[model samples]
Target: MSLLEIEDLRVTFATEAGPVEAVRGVSFSLSRERLGIVGESGSGKTMTGRSVLRLIRAPGRIEARRMSFDGIDLARIPEREMRALRGRRIAMVMQDPKYSLNPVMRVGRQLTEGLRLRDGMSARAARAKALEALEAVQIRDPERVLEAYPHELSGGMGQRVMIAMMLIPEPDLLIADEPTSALDVTVQAEVLRILDGLVRERGMGLMFISHDLNLVSRFCDRVLVMYRGRIVEEIEANRLSQAQHPYTRGLLNCLPTIGGPRQPLPTLTRDAAWLE
Candidate 1:
């Protein structure tokens, strides 16, 4: 069975313009492999990830015909049970660690908080686990990093810490929304390597959401191309260049080539039929 299954998932928000559907009848399944969701900023990639954890706030509503994780019905689970499953069974790594990590809290505290509070690990044990997790992500001087504040770490370092904290629980699935979008090419490669290693070693399903089609094509096994609020096409990562959808083709055309073209990049043309 798939690690995660989502069918006809819809997310909507009430607005002066009436109800706005952010995610329109999306359906997909994930196994113990990397699945990438690629689209523009308003394409509902992030919302789909957040809805899996029932993180949609007031004003925003999530509805689905079915949403399950590991045989458990996520759409029907009580809030308390869902809370218990959130960090221990499923984890998320946001795009920007600066916004995800608490500025006021020390890194060590944030990393160990769920371990101690949710898992009921003792302070010493939690600290040890936190150190181990930090090390797993190739963070040198784990002790020093644990003592530092979120703001004290560089963008790359902060992102690594976020990955560490999320992995500390050893979740069955991870939803990473643009995890390396804020870093340089070198740092991004490092972060991707760490994520790749963890996914392979732990056999965890990963839902990687990103706007970078090239990166997604390289990193993921399967790619779901989202346009507007729906998935317009699904293709093998290696065959992304052969996508038949017009929107997917347009997105691919917009990617700047290394030594190929020096002229102006092509503008993406939109079709209203894509929303239907």
Candidate 2:
């Protein structure tokens, strides 16, 4: 069965002007593979990711014909039940680890918290698992990292810690929202490599949301190009160069060629029809 399925999914916020729809009729299915949702800021990619986890708060609401994970209806489930599903069954890795990690908590404590609570593990077992997870993410010194706080780690280290925390639960699906955006370019690739390896090894479905077209195309199995609250095009990652949608083409064109002659990059031109 598909790991996740959504039909006619919509998200709207109560703005001063009126109810503004952030995601409109977004629909897709995922299995044990990486699926990339690419778009610019305010394109609804992140909102869609959060909505899948039912993370939208008051003043914002989610509506959908159907939203299911492994045949269970997510839209109809109670918040309490949804809480059980989240983190254990479905986890998310955010853009910045500093904001996600607890400021005052020791890294090991935060890392072991979920396993202890959810898996009914003893403190010693949880710590062992946490250390193992950190090792899996390629942390140089898991012992020292466990004792340190979030503020003591570098951006790249923090991000790896976040990924390790998410992986500890062995979730069936992972929603990574711009997870590598804050890291240096070289560090970004290393983080992705670690994440990619884990996802493949675990056979977990992945929802990778980011604005970097080239990165998404190379990393994910399939690509969904979202524009202004809707998916403008869906294509295989390898065939991204042949995307039919003008918006997709425009995004690809904006990427500067590595060895090509130096020239001013082209600006993207949007059509009013795309917002329809």
Candidate 3:
């Protein structure tokens, strides 16, 4: 059986104008493999990830014919149980480190929280586990990083710290929402490589959300292209060049070629029916 399954999932947010449908009729199954969700902003990739964890706020609604993780019905699971599942079974690495990290807390304290709660290790053991996790993410100065405040770290450092916190639990499924969107290209590559390696090595299911189609195609085994909250196309990663949907095709054409002749890229045209 798949690790996670989502069927006809829809989410609506209350607005002054009216209720806005953020996700519509999205369905997919995840195995111990990398699955990419790519879409422009407001296309519901983030919302879908949040909904699976039952993290949606009031006035926002989620509806799915069925949503399950490892044969357990997520929709039927109690919030308390869901809380236990979160960070322990299925973990999420949010988009930005600046907003995710606590300024007042030391990085080591935060990493140890994951180890303590998820692994039930002793305080001293948690501290050691935190250092090990920090080292696993290639942080050379794990001791210093543990003692330093969040504000003391660079963007890349903070992100690696976030990665360590998320992975310290050895979760079976990972949901990373543009985890490298804030870093430099080199740092971004490093973070992605670390995550990809962890997923492959541990045989964990990954729900990789991003706007960069090329990167997703290269890193993920399967691709799901979402537009205006609905999944418009699903394709094997290597065959992304042959995507059938117009939205997917447009997204590919929109990427600036590395050495190709300079030309004004075509803008993506929207179709009202595509959202229906």
Q: What does candidate 3's lDDT look like per residue over 138-189, in tens digits? A: 8999999999998899999999999999888888999999988889998899
TM-score of each predicted structure versus truth:
0.97, 0.98, 0.96
Tens digits of per-residue lDDT for model 1, 152-258: 99999999999999998899999999999999999999999999999999999999999999999999999999987899999999998899999999998987788
lDDT of each residue in 1-276, candidate 2, tens digit only? 799999999999999999999999999999999999999999999999999889999799999999999988999999899999889899999999989999999999999888788788999999999999999999989999999999999999999999999999899999999999999999999999999999889999999999999999999999999998999999999999999999999998987787976888887899999977
lDDT of 3 at 159: 94
lDDT of each: 0.95, 0.95, 0.91
Clashing pairs in 1: none
* Model 3 weakest 10-residue run by lDDT: 111-120
> Model 2: clashing residue pairs?
none
Off by over 4 Å in 3: 117-120
| C-alpha root-mean-square deviation, each candidate | 1.0, 1.0, 1.3
Candidate 1 at residue 58, lDDT? 74
Write down the lDDT that model 2 would get: 0.95
